[model samples]
Target: MDLSIINQIRSAFENLPDYRKPGNNLKYAVEDAALSAFAVFFTQSPSFLDYQQRMQKLHNRNNAQSIFGVHQIPSTSQIGNLLDPIAPETLFPVLAEMGDRLYTQGYLEPFISIGDTLLVALDGTDSFSSEKISCPCCTQQTLKNGPTLYRHTLVTPVIVAPGQSRVLPLPPEFVRVQDGVDKQDCELAAAKRWLTTWGAHYAPRGITVLGDDLYCHQPFCEAVRAQHMDFLLVCKPDSHALLYEWVTDFERTGEVQTIEKSRWNGKQRMTERYRYLNQVPLRNSDDALMVNWCEVTILNAKQQVVYRNAWASSHTLDEHNVVEIVAAGRARWKIENENNNVLKNHGYHFEHNFAHGKQHLSNFLATLNLLAFLAHTSLEWLDEAYHAVQTAAPSRRTFFENLRTLLQFIPFDHWQHLMQFMLYGENLLPRKT
Candidate 1:
């Protein structure tokens, strides 16, 4: 086993405060419970702890204790009850540490996009909803003539690049009930809170925030600018009528011009049309922030429009770097396709409701799952052994399925041994089956 990496995973959970009464000695340590909760996500199994319990009974050891540093396995209810009260922020520092590790290991070098900036995509995703299931942290909206819908949402940010498919995730910010507020929490509000909490964390890094049309508004753009961060927000003509109106006026006045270029994407050649204005007012208000506006359209060989989008930015739009800027902006889909979709649909089963409690359970479990993904992605990027195992499997789903099957048949003394068997087809695996 890579003790160093395993120790890092163990330490992330160790950082959470134990909210349980100390005088009431518990069967499992708080770190153990948190790690046990995390193990479910790590293995992509719903009954990870149940199998580990059986493993302990049969072999006197289990992967939870061996690989996860969990002294005692936690029941599903116990894990939820234990983790429900701990704020998700309690585990955020570990994400920064993980990023730092990746940076030091040179794993993040390929993720740097144009302008030496890390493209961070921001979007909110609904975690769960149930008419009967409601928690203090749940957001509720009453239907027009039906039962109120209780749901949970989180704003996820992930670092992406133009061509690199691997996206490194940042610690998420949950949209939950807030103090001293009568109105329901919203995605934009949650993003601001996210920026306030982690802006300084990103201030020193070369970051360019990417988002949908909803984030192209003045206040949101201003907040990102205030953080000393750049932005490439989707600016639709309909939504930014005043801005587009300015574009029309500038074109008539000959102040607005376009820079067109043709580039080949593999065998297919396409024309890129770029229309930009260096300085423009964002809104009709006199005090509106001055910003750069640009639009890009791609046409194929037949001259049929293939793709088109407009954006507002803090950088000047010019022919020298328009393609790179567009690529960075277009990477916003990575947050949805590579990050959120993988979490929800692919194999993480993120929205499957591991367990929900009255307080922070739903969001907390989601956080743990994301951390697990970060850990695995880190390994895939940094560890040759894990990479070798991945190559041996036909697909990611097969790799995880084989891992869970191996865990059930026998207990591996270390994580490395399991990978060794998978990679070499060695007889080192004990046969409890």
Candidate 2:
């Protein structure tokens, strides 16, 4: 991890307006509290601060202060108290700035296609939920027993590509009850807010938003067009009666095009059939947007279709690029598998309730976790020292295990020292500075 990045993050938190009573002088620094919270996620350990605070007592130094730039360690309750009032939106700039750096360094180029258009997959996942615990921001729904269950859902937009395993994410939008709105909040509403607020961040660079059938409708597509961006959304036939009716009608006219090929998948011969239609009306209305639709099916030797999907695209569908478009569309799974699954099942503990303050603590903690994940991803991909450690580790779990182990037992003056210890397979001492 870059020290400069942590410095910038600390600065961002420090610069956030305290919003506390001007007459009151807080004992703990707000930025330090925030950084301590981030350190919890960064280390993937809720007890990270307790252990580091012990180290500070014994050695007069702590990993949280040294590695993440925390000047004062705050209790978990204090961390939530200091961060509750600051909206998660305050952290969006950090995500954007980090992405700009990644792009400038050409780390994001592999995700580019269709003339600088990066594929941004959008989806919602549950961040936290409890049947008994609830906050003002939590979305409430009556359960089968007539008891209300409160939950938080987050809409994540990530930069992804078909062949790439690594995915980079933008700041997520939380789906929750707002101050002035009486309507029941939902993921689509959060997504709309995400696109309107952050869409400009991506439009200048070219973006093609990817989502499921929930976003394939006319209004959402119009929203994408309004931002001067494009969309490649999953279009399920069951939901689009008129659109499929048009396709069925076009089938009678022999206007639908198809391509077939056979390939070996090591175990069986797979036959892929791709079908496409260009300039099809998205709805039956006279003013329907003319979208390009493509569908693909993969059949096994048993002649059973093993995989099937369709996408409605803003780009023109043609023989030359339809396969590429479909491949990119299929990559939407990375948002679920590579991003959400990692956060939940890996080490980040997305569903765990680290904090649930009265106001913004839940969302703020989630954003901090995302920022830490982003930092680690950048290190994994862009830092040579980190890459050396990654190459030597047996798996991602083991890599983070080694990091946490070192942070607990050892002290290093530089991040690369830990990398060197792992890479060289030797017991090492902290470098003399």
Candidate 3:
């Protein structure tokens, strides 16, 4: 933690009054909430009260009030009560602003390529949904034996080129039942809303959105085109029966192109085959959209084929950029492996039960934890001093372990002072001057 960065974050919090000013003489400010949320990631605790208790013991000698910047730190019940009443709208913007700041401060530039096109991947994940912990946003179901209930959210991230290490998250939209309405919410509907809202903001920058086979429908493609954005959505044989039928019809007329090649990888040989269809209509309707389709196959030296896939894109592919588009489309898996998987299975424990307030507590805490991750990722990607400390350590895990250990034992007036000590490997007290 760098005090300078913490100060900058504090300054950002100053502008968000909803997080701070709820009533007269409220002890804790928004900064405390933000800090408590951040602490959950490193500690992997189940509740904000537990996080506060840990922080107080580690840094404030059990004096939670002093550590949390109030006359007294709010109890776990207080935190839950406070969070349940607040709206999710207030916190999401702050997280988005932090992301913007990370970009403006040059932390994200290295991961992004200097090109006219950017790849934004859209995916849906169930972050908070439980039959027991039901909220207004929970989706209900009816079982053959009884009633049913659940919740879900659609997560969209602005990723750079494929295989890149960073993927910045956009605000998520929870899918819940509508009052007096009888339609069950789906990911496609959520995605449509996401695009209409945030997607419009980035369409002018020439973004290409990527998604799974479910997004290759005519309506979805038309919606994306309406937003002035392109798409590279997966197209499976089973789902695109009409398109495959058309391809089969066209192939009989010799209207398809195929390329095959072989290469050696030291111990083994590999083969790759590419099949393409250009300027094909996506549907049979009179105003059907045109798209490009490509399929890839790979075989190993054992004479066994190892990989197969297909994709459909709004971008017209020629010899010059077909490979690039395919690569970008294939890279959508990174969001699953690097972002979602890391948050859940790795140290972040994103699925771990934190607090689920009646209102926005769970969502707000989730937003804060994500912001901390983004901040940490930016530091890893951009900050020279922070990078130096990691470079000296054996690995990133080791670096974080040591960093946490130091935070537990040492008390500093600010975050930068702690960073300075870590970088220099010296005991330096907060400056009196």
Instruction: Return the top candidate by lDDT.
Output: 2
Candidate 3 C-alpha lDDT tens digits along 195-309: 8877666676567888999899899998898999888999898987778887788889888777777888797889887778887777777887888898878889876879888
Query: What are the lDDT figures for the candidates, one per model?
Result: 0.84, 0.87, 0.67
Report the candidate with higher TM-score, 1 versus 2. Answer: 2
Per-residue lDDT, model 1, residue 100, is: 75
Worst lDDT 10-window in candidate 2: 423-432
Taking the tens digit of each residue's C-alpha lDDT, what string does model 2 give over 326-425?
A: 9989999999999999999999998899878888888888999899889888877767777766767789899888888888877666665556776666
Taking all chains together, the TM-score of candidate 2 against the true structure is: 0.96
Q: Residue 164 lDDT in model 2? A: 94
Task: Let me know the TM-score candidate 3 reaches against the reference structure.
Answer: 0.85
Q: Which wins on TM-score, candidate 2 or candidate 3?
A: 2
- Candidate 1: TM-score? 0.94
Segments in model 3 whose C-alpha atoms lie over 4 Å from true places: 2-8, 15-25, 42-72, 102-115, 141-149, 178-181, 424-433
lDDT of 2: 0.87
Model 1 regions more than 4 Å off: 22-25, 263-269, 426-433
Kindly indicate the candidate among 2 and 3 with the higher lDDT: 2
